[model samples]
Target chain A: MRVNRPKDGDPISVALNAQERHVTFDASRGAEAPPELVQLLTPEGERVEHPAYDIDLTPEEVRGLYRDLVLVRRVDMEAVALQRQGELGIWASLLGQEAAQIGSGRALTDADMAFPTYREHGVAWCRGVDPVNLLGLFRGVNHGGWDPAEHNFHLYTIVIGSQTLHAVGYAMGIQRDGADAATIVYFGDGATSQGDVNESFIWASVFNAPVVFFCQNNQWAISEPLEKQSRIPLYRRASGFGFPGIRVDGNDVFACLAVTRQALKNAREGQGPTLIEAFTYRMGAHTTSDDPTRYRVAGELEAWKLKDPIERVKAYMFKNQLADQDFFDSIEAEAADLGRDVRKRCLEMPDPHPLEIFEHVYSEPHALLTEEREQYAAYLASFEGGER
Target chain B: MTTLTLAKAINEGLRTAMEDDSKVLIMGEDVGKLGGVFRVTDGLQKDFGESRVIDTPLAESGIIGTAIGLALRGYRPVCEIQFDGFVFPAADQIITQLAKMPLRSLGKIKLPVVVRIPCGGGIGAVEHHSESPEAYFTHTGGLRVVACSNPVDGYHMIQQAIRCDDPVIFFEPKRRYWDKAEVERGAAPLAFDRAQIVRPGTDVTVLTYGPMVKTCLEAAAAVEQDGRSLEVIDLRSLNPLDTEMVFESVRRTGRCVVAHEAPVFSGLGAELAARITEACFYSLEAPVLRAGGFSTPYPPSRLEDHYLPDLDRVLDAVDRTFAF
Candidate 1:
């Protein structure tokens, strides 16, 4: 009854060597994108039309989108500076994916809920979460600074693809309640390889849960490129799970907004889940802790720089004459004010009470927690007299 | 009072909780139609309707991940993992997400979710079915782990777990599911976090939980013929262990024997032994002895009788404690 179990092999030697040549980021050859991508605005600020998704924005609406893009970029820039200045521990900079986040975030109604990954500061801004509150996590003062229930936005989930299943579950609850409100969950291309994400797609498809799976394909998951994760396009994985999958020019704010809005509408109208793959790139390191120079070439960044999310929006504003010079100056001033306020507030943020660690472990009181708290207090008091 | 098996009592408790709160829902694999592999959720979907009692796809991570979502939406979800060995697939959700979300939110939100797992070996079941993985949940910080020994406790604890605001890991002893006891249907049971002295004795204290409670109790009864009285305590809650009760029993008996189905290496017994030694060091007449499964993977069904702790093993540990 001896069983001959398979032995482990080198993944680099086995999968990489055989498939490396065939795996290409170019979407021209029967890949997941290029054909199904719904782009309302090109990289050069040219306006276009889509058959399934479109939006007729007023001058004010167009200016509002532009302001959102600039402000979010400002917040990201300030946070990066704060990290470099040693005010914060680490930061996940959303340098290139501003349009993808702001577009989908702004599309949500007051009733729609969003479950975000840790790098969704743009979405947080659109949800009206104070940018300073976002610093609490990076500053090592708190895990989350705002109440999720207050803004219908959940705390940022750091674990890769874990939030997708929760989004689907929340959507199922909304279905059971017979509510028209929908749920949107954001993740990265790296998270598409996680088991929880695939499981969520299956559950959402079967239960017809009202959720939007928004994957910002930022090309690199740390050191591994998109070629390492999937051979086909990520959105194509959605159709296999019995749902409509769409790709959008993530750098184009117009396209992201329109596609996301349509997806939410489909969910609210009981059409089930939709996977919107935002074809974008991470313009910076994975985080302040990472060094992209170790793995990626400088040319890749240069290529993505020409298709900058904020630059395209700014170009569109200039070409369409949607906003005046006064409006642009006011926005710059507002962004400066936000950055200064965030910096001051972040520096002044008080550390939480030492005993706060034991507070939320359980909702009800327990004997063990009481004992542990008492022990910790005594341990802390032992050092009180030594400082003198 | 009604005589019911432990499984039936849990079913009744679930029904009562669902009836009491409209937000209470049951979701798991084969939970709606097949009534669960252990039949613990039998006939629940029929009475509660399809919306409340959901039959989920065969994905453990999906079950728990969605359960967290439901909790966020103001629903008390009681998720059933079919077997103890099957809970690993959902470990990320259970340990990382569900357990840490409330703490991460800084008390702004609470996940009122109960994950019910049928655990421990003894029914002659094969791999991925019989296992005592309670230590994993108990080791996690934000979860409250509890195990029931009999029908009465099962009935009351299942309801209390559902009502609990924090996420609870409810470990049901699979071998004892069919064990019957008289349950007061409408009456209150013991507190969810308290331990009970199932049998009073003065010679030695026998501490155990879940499926091992029955074995320890039987061992205590058998030792009575040899003119030795063994005190037995059922530690219902594992995380917030009733240390006071354990210390009190050990002080009177002056000896302790901890028994469980999990491996002895860093098992619940190790923690209990350390705490008991710290609290009742002067009162102890002998060192704490543990009777548990070997430090190996759960063996096949044919060899489970030897793998799982039994009355003979419990008595052997008690004798060793006295020999010291």
Candidate 2:
């Protein structure tokens, strides 16, 4: 039954209709796992080695990863609070997937590029983007705040599966330039259903483009479940496009780091694309606007809380005697300061002036725009009250 | 001056752009070995090699989406969308991503990507083959939309579009691909955004573009013996129109008629009529008239002759401007 797949439609029905095979939706997992997961650290903080993927991080590096996971969580918490306080229009919280972002983000070489979905605040932290720069976008002060070339990280792409094609194109450009560097693009399980993402897969395959498709399957896309996207595990979909795929324990930073490093290396070596499905869960509401209570049970949340991503890293450090009380306390203090700084900076972001709408619409001098701007400015000046 | 067909002119223009910039690439379906279905990229792969001239898969969204990425990576990728109707499949990339990315970047980056589309219907072809979907892109702010009516404009404007710092939607009339014209390669060419006075007259100012330019000029000659002088103007660029040239002609004639091969309702012709009325309101002899397709899907090709604007319809529209 597993060898001979039926047609797709209602993934659960298709998956169940296949004879003698069971399709189960684990509280945190998407599809039934036929492919073994690469896990370097268990939820209980025990350090384990995968047969195919392994990493030997120095104690200092593990502490840094721990610090990253904590600070990014703090940032996300502050953003959520800001939205509730009416300081931001909305915020998409990356509450549960820190290890997946940081581990994969850090694996990128300085020469490598990353195309990320909007929820990659943790990856932005890894890329050295100022925490304050991210707030500008949420504050509605700018669409994109930081220069991509400055960090080798492209601006957050909001359209699902759109950036994947750009990532492939950039990889194709790399091939043309004969560059050894590779590119990695981040998306959700929901984006796998988009034609652009599927087209990107074909493009990467045929051109032998150096691009890694990193899918952080947080189990939910707004309100829809993973069954709506695929019957097979998302990583397994890559083999149909003629590339290697693997599932990694997204909550385990060591496993994520090891798996991503190998995938990127394979791409740079001209082995073509690799799809790394980082299995994780979205522990928080999708955004400030969504209500998880509408669809899911509280017990699922309680179950996932036991396997918190940051807790596992902290436990691993403690068991190995890698970090002590002072180190953990300092990380906590640093996160607190970052949270306060981001809020202050976000409030201080000036609202763009009305005339600024005409700015940056084009690189060349547009006559029509110039005429419209002048006319609008004259009209505004005529408003008996100035600056209205 | 060398005479060449519109397709060959664009092919030569692409060759010129490639020769000048090593970073320029041509990517689309069948662009490499097939030189495109219209042969607009003929022999380009032979000269530039596979690295620069790429044959993409049969995915419009992929061609355009990847072109955006290639542009971000510092390569000027001139993408071909095969036909006009097929552009809708890639419209998401064009409108949301390609048109908005540079603006979203706040001028920190420039997308020099040029999207080449074969537009307008006169060719006897099936659906999704012949269409004039220019108004959609023209309405998009960050893009520059231009169409070439003849070979020289096709040659010079294509090369110029490649050199611009902005993303350009270049429409090459499919029906006029074999039309021949003299191209003065070394002479200073007018900018692609400027309009041209194809035929000068004192009575009526008729504005048209792309495939309809030839028909409008033919209408002008048809009206000459009837003692009604008509001036035909080809608006090469649609978005930031050359209103200076248009206003000059409209003011002198005191009459205006907008013509195209798109739908008459809410189409590019409507936008032109509004702009002309605003600028030449007092100089007008009548409300700007329009002559083009009806509000319907481009009908079966057997009826395309009735659907597309021809000489009589243009003359009638021009004659109506004298009514007021």
Candidate 3:
């Protein structure tokens, strides 16, 4: 299909554009899973080998990855259901991109740090942050629900491409501290358009900062497709910035794990930055508020489900007799319990007192806040019975 | 006691801050080798080495964005936006990220990052080089905004801002760079946010900051011939404006005038005028008058004299306040 962005044009041009602007979603190309895609596990339960990147996973480890992928997806589904039921303001589902998040997320050593764009729920799970903490931000109870220093997982940045520079800066700090640790930042295909991301690429390269740029090219950034974000492949774009760029099979959990571990190792070894383009698909809408039906083809979702990050792992486990029906049943029961617990805890979360607005704006006391807080308290008191 | 130019004092202050805290880093374009356009960070890289004194690629947003990350990693990064007008490129980082990062983290983090921008007109520099954009920052919450007018404050205030746990937008008047004054190096510095009454008087209270502090002081001396005493208050801190101190002066003087190189329309002067009028309403004998640049953008260097607030323009405001 010809690339046609919706535009109001002159009569002659409008006539030329009208037919192609009638965009029919075509996932028939199977959504362009790259030929160069580094895959360890194939779609139908086969363990494949890659020349450069490969990991020897024990059956238990493979099952463990499957558990992570399943649980993360389950948590994401719970959040989505909560959003539909008005329990959450919004939820950015990590549906098809679970392996991309969990694999890369699990690759980080305890000393390394992470900076995430708002959708890295799987990453947050790997970082030891309570899944409920993520809900608080979605529930509007707080801006961010956990301390970055506590988890080494910085708060989810809502602004597109803003966190990439922060990641590089954190890496530079680690470099200065003489620590053998790296920083990983999660952004999407669309964020590559932002000047800050490009600048971060320059910074990461020039400073020889120990950082990894993990871009999950999940096919769509809200409504725009991959073609809108870049002309060249997202990974290859890193070459111009003087860094090694690799395209990993984002759905294959093993590839994500192996590639990320190698990238982080290279970073800690003082080899500067690596851009890992995790080739995957957004199986669901961007957020609860988004409608993929409006801009995407339905068959695209179907095509990606075949290469689902969790299913392939499950298939591999079953083929290898990694577990019996009891194991699958147990995981399902655990997922159900987690969903119920999340819903209950989210509903129980209380609204902060109005006066809490005066808090945290400044770490130190300011005369303006002192007066504003006091005067606001008195004003509230002056009301009938303080409040209704 | 030693006499140093405002630029030199800031350079010394930065040097002192770097010595005091190993985590404090200085990053900007040309800050490492060139020592900055106005030499405010002169000789810093030579002493602190390249690690602490960083000459980043010429991108304002990148400079601040990385600084935020550094601050998150427990490093105090002082970023420099090469010029006043260039800060808008990083406004997303400064406004969306730097200003709100602390509140977003619910005080779990402290960003002791300082963004230094050389501001104001009168250096005969080109457009964008001479603009006072303090109002934009002061209007934003969660960011502490400050400007130092003279060498003493320049020396001590830079250190104070560095020590401040909040993200501070520190403005240095470009015109006042060469202005020299005595700085008692070892003396304990005044608090960062306190407003000082530079010259005491009982006539009209003229409140100003940064570049205009000197102008207001000059206006006070110029109006002294008319047997009028103008109380000049240099509001060192703009965001948590020392309005209480201004109220004290304005209540006594009964008239007020606010001056700055920034445009009079919706400038920091407007906020000062409104606050002073509101608090000292009954005590104020006249409405607060503002003397500042025109609403237009900072004009060419040749036309800056007319656009910027001069001693005569300030005196005119002081005279108008009396007439009221």
Candidate 4:
């Protein structure tokens, strides 16, 4: 049931004969290749049906997804505003990548593991991590704040593409432990050029690790365009590494959810890894300090305005009778309340004391650290309470 | 008891650790089939199988990053950096992430990973291969840096390092890999962060470690012939320096000289001198002296003999220490 090459044909039958098998490849033949997009809802207030996979969401569940997208965006905006107001040291805005993060984030079960880059505040939100915990990393206080065992979500990795390999390794561990959980690793388009990312792909394909490589193609890596990052389409690049590649409209929450759910099921059932290129745009600056006006033209931003992830979902909800005016008003209230709570938490975060720096260095104890802490404590005590 | 070389001692130490803890794993390039370039990890893969002993891709940062996650899952990983120069790509991970993860977690989580790097320059190697970069790790907090001089310390210290709850940088002096000594495999050995007085003398205290330990001891022997006793102490752990032993020797000898193969400015020698002056200021017979490489890049093989701190250079520092 292990097939390493995408071009191979005989293995498809072998995979079908397996006990947990399901129909994956569509049988419809066409002269031109299928546009990799799978959708149950369009970008402009329209509901469409997918011939391969259909969506049967209840009214409450549909409204819930919309609420998640709006609230996650609200929290994102608050963090960005905090950065501008000198509250945070730095911030990586997940402006247009919300649907990509939230959609894929909500697709996993509680048993699933997730690896995130520095820009995964949206994913962290979906994983039940408080906004304050996310702020601790950007503040000078801590590196990561959430426990992996609790939420099955790892801390944000800053080194470009390094988390991909870690995700692959964890997936291998999952396979060895005979767990039915699949790992999802999130990275940007910029990371796809790194050696670690490519190496992760090769290892994932070779070992058949139950993992998903979710690449958020957010157009600009600081200032470099997607054109500079890759020549061919990003999704097609996955085909070269012996995995099925899919290009989904990252701004479409329904499409993102459906595609990600399918990919995770395939991986958990021992179908190996899949590369998902969520083609989205970086609507905001790369981080708090970045000024996007230097590299990009205003026309490009105007063009992407039509593809706003939240607005399209809102349009669909209003066009259909899935959500009424009361639901929309209540969601707005919730978003405002969440934003206020985040602001209060960010401001009330007490600065860690100097002595707190030496704790948690080792699980047992170190003779050297114990000595240094003692000496450092005396040094700190020598100073007055008001001022050092 | 067995008389094993430094290389074989490390191999045995790794083997013992893997056998003792099922969660302990060994990872590096060429570590599985080749048993490491120096054979320090020999026969491990055959016994532990490919699942436990992993041969990683040619990426240093990748090895360390994944090891961090594995540690989060309650696994102890011992990573080999292959050579001195190869560790730089992982320096970012070591200095920023690995060093900060434990304390940053605020006593909730710990990263008990060991990074074994083959260091120092006397072995006729090309550019980037011969480097002495211990200062970088020693400067970082939340990391314990230690170097082994001979077979006995190499064996016991490695086991202690693995059992330790902290992330330890175990630097193996490449030149001393072939040197042999009888080592004991036991429950516990020397204290993890304490310094060992290799040679006890009185006139002057010579502080050194790793490859320079042998050179300092040789210089001590030569100085003994000249009607002078030189106290040679190996500061095994560099970060949390065994200040008690250092001050004790400096208090007796009254004169001190520090030797290492790294560049002179801002090297481990500078830190040792600063600490000694702070600890034993009144006991000084002369100002502290240092013998180290020049403030430049490691030179060609023909000039490396000059670049490395040999017995003559150490003795010269001793002469300056006494003359002061």
TM-score of chain A by itself in each prediction: 0.93, 0.92, 0.91, 0.89
lDDT of each: 0.92, 0.91, 0.91, 0.85
How are the candidates ranked when ordered by lDDT, highest leading? 1, 3, 2, 4
Could you tell me every candidate's TM-score relative to the true structure? Answer: 0.97, 0.96, 0.96, 0.90
- The residue pairs that clash in candidate 3, if any, are none
> CA lDDT of B217 in candidate 1?
87
Query: Alpha carbon lDDT of residue A200, candidate 3?
Result: 99
State the lDDT of candidate 2 residue by residue for B172-233, as single tens digits.
Answer: 99999999999989878898789999999999999999999999999999989999899899
Tens-digit lDDT track of model 3 for A1-388: 8985656776767876644543542321323463377999998879998899889888788778888888889889999999999989999999999999999999999899999999999999999988988998899999996999989999999999999999999999999999989999999999999999999999999999999999999989899987666656888878899999998999988999999999999999999999999999999889999988999878878888899888888888899999899999999999999888888898999998889998999999988888999999999989998963
Question: Local error of candidate 3 at A125, Å?
Answer: 0.3
Please give the DockQ score of every candidate, comma-separated: 0.85, 0.83, 0.84, 0.32
lDDT of 1 at A179: 90
Ranking by DockQ: 1, 3, 2, 4
Q: DockQ score of candidate 2?
A: 0.83
lDDT per residue for candidate 4 within B1-324, as digits (tens), equals 898999999999999888899888898889998999999999999999997888987778878876776676677889999999899988877887778776655666677889999999888989988888999999888889999999988988988888887899999999999999988887468887899999989899999999999999889888787898998999999878888999999999999999999998999999889988998999998888999999999999899999898999999888887676
Best of the two (1, 2) by DockQ: 1
- Evaluate model 3 with DockQ and give the value: 0.84
Reference interface contacts recovered per candidate: 0.87, 0.73, 0.81, 0.44
- Candidate 4 residues A166-248, lDDT tens each? 78877877776788899999998899998778878887887788999999988888997766566566777788999998888
